[model samples]
Target: MLLALAVVPAVVQEAVLVGIGFHGARGLAPQVTAVWPYDSYHDLRWLLIYHNSWWHFLFGLVALAVFRGLLSAGLTALAWPGQVPRPSFAWLLRRNLEVAALALVVISPWAALSVAFSAVALSLYLFASLIPMLVLAPFLQRAGVARTWWRGLPTIELLGWSVLNFAVLTIAGAVISSTSGWWGVLVAALAGVANGLLWRQTVTAAVLPARIRLARVPVAPVAIILTMAAAVAAQPILNLVTGPPQEWMPLVVTERLPDRVPHAVIVIAGHDSHWSGRQPADPRVERFSYQGLDRQGRPLPYRHTATHRSLDSSSVLLRAQVEALHRRTGRPVALIGSSEGAMVARTYLEKGPKPSPVEAVLLFSPLIQPGRAYYPPPGYSGWGVATGWELRGLFWLVGLGRADRSRPDEPFVRSVLVNAPFYRNRTLCPVAGVRMIAFLPTVSAAEAPPGEYSRIPVFQLPAFHGGLIGRRAAEERVVDFLAGGHVDQPRREYALLQRLGAAWQAPPLALVLNPVWAAEREADPAFTGRICEPR
Candidate 1:
């Protein structure tokens, strides 16, 4: 009954906002049409009036606060039951108004911030919000159902529960909205029901007796750890029995020469599924597959297993195959890898006890990073903050040799690869002797060591990630380099390379994207910064 009453105001406010928005749209249409002759004016008016209207912001904030308060009260009542008495209609209204005012004052200031700045705001808000809860948890339990005043409220616990509920609901809504048709609605409805049951279970657990709670405390973590271990232990058996899917099989293109020693190019594909089973079809260059397959000959997708272990195993297998091929055909081998594959190749070279059979190594779109700060892209700044926590959780799972197959697109593997400090250490850069060439696209160019190393040549490509994979010009350059020829292009044209020559060194990961660099440059005319300067 209390939940129903709380929801009534929210429903009414939503309906009123829809009506107002529709009326505003109708009134603005004529003005939009009148300004259509001037494209710039029309765009400006549309952006200002339709997209960034103050009225919309006000209405949205009120609606969000009302819904949040309603959900908060409902969950609190559910959790504490007899202890948390049902709020009166007047009490509910007061609480909603308080929440709405807080949202407007505290959150609205940071709403206009950029993605990265907004992430900072979100972290601050989450931390600030949790403090009150941690402090009030004991007080709320002590208060029981004694008073109906604001001073006696369990605002922190209520807000925390509501936030979790909101997250589940939001995810369901997103899935529904992103889907094509009525199936989405059905799925969302089922999700909603499941979420409600889950919420009930969560509340029950929260209110469990002291003895029961203590007894179950260690069970969950232990179970999770054990399950992950079992999964990792079982992977080899699964791989052997299932066989690699056909797509996972190495794609080999052979080039045989009559008299001279044949030259072999071993290509290691990246994380992208599109590159699976891809091979260079050049007659002069033989392409050998380094990625492993299951027993059934089906491809084991990169995301299907614990990547670090799988890649390590695959790297070992690759060396054995290359050695056998070198023995039989007397071929000189060249290793070429892209993205995650590049990281794997680098790992093999670094960890191997002896020098590999490969005569040269060419890395494209390598995943080497100085630290965690450089992992996320510009667009990932905001949501990446939250996803970082998820990555931490999955990192342990992967460390235990368990694969998180549920979310293939999640940057868990990338997170692991980027944070591996050994790979980023300049002192441990692949041992000398072998010819090494790094062809890095703009985004990943920072991964390469600054300046020229003895046998390592870092070439910057004026393109984004994955741009050099199949391009004819890029492929030709790679082939030429592998054949003991240097890249003919002017190296000075690349901004990153030029900066390296000008004493612009790669900064630590935390400072790489620091806004202070921009601020310092803006403040001083001749301030040449280490980070974010030209490069």
Candidate 2:
């Protein structure tokens, strides 16, 4: 309840502000501006300020319970004359000193959210909460009523839950223009409680028996240690089996825009974590920024102004390229985007004068939104989008592992790729009727907002092993764009499908510029020198 009292007000405040921003703003533009300025800070601060309140409250309640036990023993000693010498207060004090220290290590940072911590604090808060739930589950299960109650636990008793709800609604409101505030809050609350209970069970079952007194020559301490280690191991294993979901990460540049006009294509490189790599990858630049380098130069600590991948610096670099293209070629240039490069293209277009300055856009398995997926379906008929797993693999190949479980303090490497200085000075994209020729493994019209996108012609490519098998998609899309051929899907699909089915599916289609060769080294080092030539 104390946790609720402390956390709810802040949450309510943020959510209310977000709702006002949503409803009160003149339209999308002002709301977008307001949402970023206040909602983000408010959401983050809310997390930091209130993460530990419930844990603190729990500590007090437990300490009180221990005190009650000790006090009862003392009173019994006076009445019964002999009984167990009322266990020494000095001994109790000394033992509890260790307990208090441990508790502080566990709870204080949570309560204070000290040190401007991020994922770690949240993890600890979760860990401390989970321990007791597991220990008590059997009892609750036996109680039947308690088990049912726990499953659909009510909001009022849970600590910091309401606060979590409010924070989620505000943030969601900030990002998605049409989210329902009350529904968002309700979903957040339910999710938080359910997750909290799950965490509590996992942690308490692992720890308390070890740290506290245990009967029968217990090895609970060692067991607890092993449990924690196993939990850590479980994470990577889970990622592998479940095929870690795609997440947004920093964008990187593969090549610079041509100084001359009518450039053939804009190549943007994808990134990867290189967990298996030994040496660090060298840095390169694709944008103009605070650090002031147009080509590969050192970076500053400053963050990008727009989305993490859409860097101001890189956008500036692209803006310069765009201006030069119009001047030199006497005709607007065409853009070729791949992977995270698509975001660079999108941001460039968002700055306006695109499709005009650049007549058309050609994307190859583009990372339109960082880490989110565009999936392909179960059968050939289902071939309209790329599945979540393929995109995750694509990122892993680029050395920019999964975004969902990202380390909070990670520097914005991908973000730097698109951070062009010029983009900051420009307005967001409002250009109309510029052609967007999208070459995707699957182009799902369903995933797109009904009318959010304009005049974008998507070309669906063939799939193999439930994924985009080769360059057929890219080739056809480019060929059509350059040739000015209207897409004839029924005829094209029949021919492609027939050829793929014949000759035992024939040889794999070749690519003009295969991203796979670059991704190969990071994916598996044994072939690094063989395929990538050890660069």
Candidate 3:
């Protein structure tokens, strides 16, 4: 009864949200009922990701009630077969009816909403079967019931009812999810139903009910595979119908140096969602410099920072822009790329239509080794993993799987691979052939191999995510790299750097090839130099 009570309101709420609330958002004409803005709003994504797990608990409770009711009624009828145990029968029937009714309530507005709600409801019901009988002692006992069965009946009914209600709510929730529009409601429902069936359990007891012991169900590996396939396929299709997100881009330029100079620099933005959020206020972007000229014919320090949204796909576009700028400005250009942007610069050098006027390249903490290590793998469970269990649950809810996973084992021998282009495939960059001066953080002897570090000159920085580069002396070293001269003589920590730079006039393909403080050694050949040392 308690579960039923919960279900009834949830179903009603879901129905109202889906049927009336959603249409109002679209300004559609009035139907049998109309909802205000707030009434129509639903958080279906939350329902899909979070509520499904909750429903698992709730459904376990309901399933327990159903199985228990069947047993109690059976035992009583056999003991005294003349009477129908009308009270118990009525309660069981009402619980089922209430849940079913709630499902309908949520489904009335949209089928997809119903499916999502139903899946969550079913998952919850199944999960509830795990709860111990002792925990439900209070709910089992109700007013006007002398027998122990009556005590458990209401709570069981309530559990069942709650499942039904949540199902309805799920439907409504799916309808209102930002990922779903009116059409997605319908598509998602079918997907949700199919996805939900994958985890269906026959037993109803927290301790494993005896009722379903004799039953047989189909289980084929092919079916499981197909279910996985269907779930994966449904999500992108639903998202497409709902709406493709609009990509955003923001650009900021800072030129605070002498004016009217002919100096120039070209920058290729990195590939990460975090890249877009970087702005002038950020010290990282602020400290990062581009070569530009002042009015007095001296080199000017300038910075053009790309917002995070633009960082994802702007690299190839920026490479082309650099070509255009080169034609227009006729200035010597230096190229700076961070992370994935380093790859973009390289690609532009190799494959872009126009010749790159950029003289040099600088890479910071590049994700050069692609494949599984590129991004942290999704966690097996919810917490502690980079991508948690909730996201996996979401994929299940939306009928999605690993179709979008990337393959990085392929060779990079050719400029253009036959199978996929990085720009079209990864949706990042299309440019190729740029040389790079790569700097990576400290790596273990076991992790570093000749193949990974062979051709490229490597500068090992301290800490994760390039902590060494953030140092002021390191920044000056970078400034010197741009200035086209290496550190000259022997010094304390930079003795190796000075020797390498002074011995070799041509810049190495990789930065930090000589040593981390090589440029500083060139700046001060004497033993007294202490610019790079911490005070």
lDDT of each: 0.39, 0.31, 0.30
lDDT tens digits, residues 504-530, model 1? 111122222333223222111011111
Query: TM-score ranking from best to worst?
Result: 1, 2, 3
State the lDDT of candidate 2 residue by residue for 1-535, as single tens digits.
Answer: 3223223333443355345432211111111111111112222222222222345434544553354234222222222213224336554444333332332322222222211111111122223323332322222211111212222222222223323333433343333223334443443333333333332332232222222222333333344344334333434654587573332211223223223323333333222211111111212112222222234232222222222333334456566665554554455556555443454566667654533466666554443212110112223211111211222332343334534343222233323212221111121122465556555443322111111222345566543211332355545445456445555232244223322111110011011112222232221111110111122
TM-score for each of the candidates: 0.39, 0.34, 0.30
Q: State, as a TM-score between 0 and 1, how close model 1 is to the true structure.
A: 0.39
- Stretches of model 2 off by over 4 angstroms after superposition: 1-263, 271-310, 319-331, 350-356, 362-430, 437-471, 478-535
| Candidate 2 global TM-score | 0.34
Model 2 is weakest, by summed lDDT over 10 consecutive residues, at 503-512
Model 3, span 403-491: residue lDDT tens: 43212111221111111122111212122343345555442111121111223344554444434345555455445555564522212
The local lDDT score (0 to 100) that residue 370 gets in candidate 1 is 29
